[model samples]
Target: MIIPKNIEELASYAEKGKNVFFFTADWCGDCSFIKPQMPEIEADFPQFNFIQVDRDQYIDVAAEWSIFGIPSFVVTNDGEELGRLVNKNRKTKEEISGFLKMVEG
Candidate 1:
């Protein structure tokens, strides 16, 4: 997963191929819990480019995307939104994989 330096960089990524913006915060327990499984998730879904967005560092971007959750996901392709799993709940690896499967379809 790559971390965008700014909102513009994130937009550029979204405008290209498949992109999954993972919104998270260092202080968030949920984010930390799922951090280790991110590589596996990315490997499982090779079609999508994962971009890590720090909620604290990119608050403006999160606000624009209406993401108030610590650990959330927004999938986009060619600048169009495909799906999102945005919420303030803890997510498991299976749940995340399931969401990606649905998005892939």
Candidate 2:
């Protein structure tokens, strides 16, 4: 996964395909915990492209996307947001995968 700090950076990844996803902030406890587990999750789901963003660094971007919290996972295809999981205290590979599958499938 790569970290993109701004919308311009995100737009480039969007050109690649529908697998583009953005993870918001390091401050969210869930995101902090999820960080360590992401490598394994990436390994299991090799088809997706992931990007990390700081909520504070990109507040405008988050608002434009209607993100209301940190620990948000905005799954997008091309330029469309498929589905998002934003800090409901659920963080697990299985749980996240099920959410993505619901959107991507």
**Model 1 regions lying over 4 Å from their true place:** none
TM-score for each prediction? 0.96, 0.82
Candidate RMSDs in Å, in order, are: 0.8, 2.0
What total of clashing residue pairs does each candidate reach? 0, 0
Candidate 1: give the clashing pairs: none
> Against the true structure, candidate 2 has what lDDT?
0.72
Clashing pairs in 2: none
Strongest candidate by lDDT? 1
lDDT of 2 by residue, 36-67 (tens): 87787777667788777777787877777777
| 78: Cα error in model 1, Å | 0.5
Per-residue CA lDDT of model 1 for 23-74, tens digit only, reads 9998999999999999999999999999999999888888999998879999
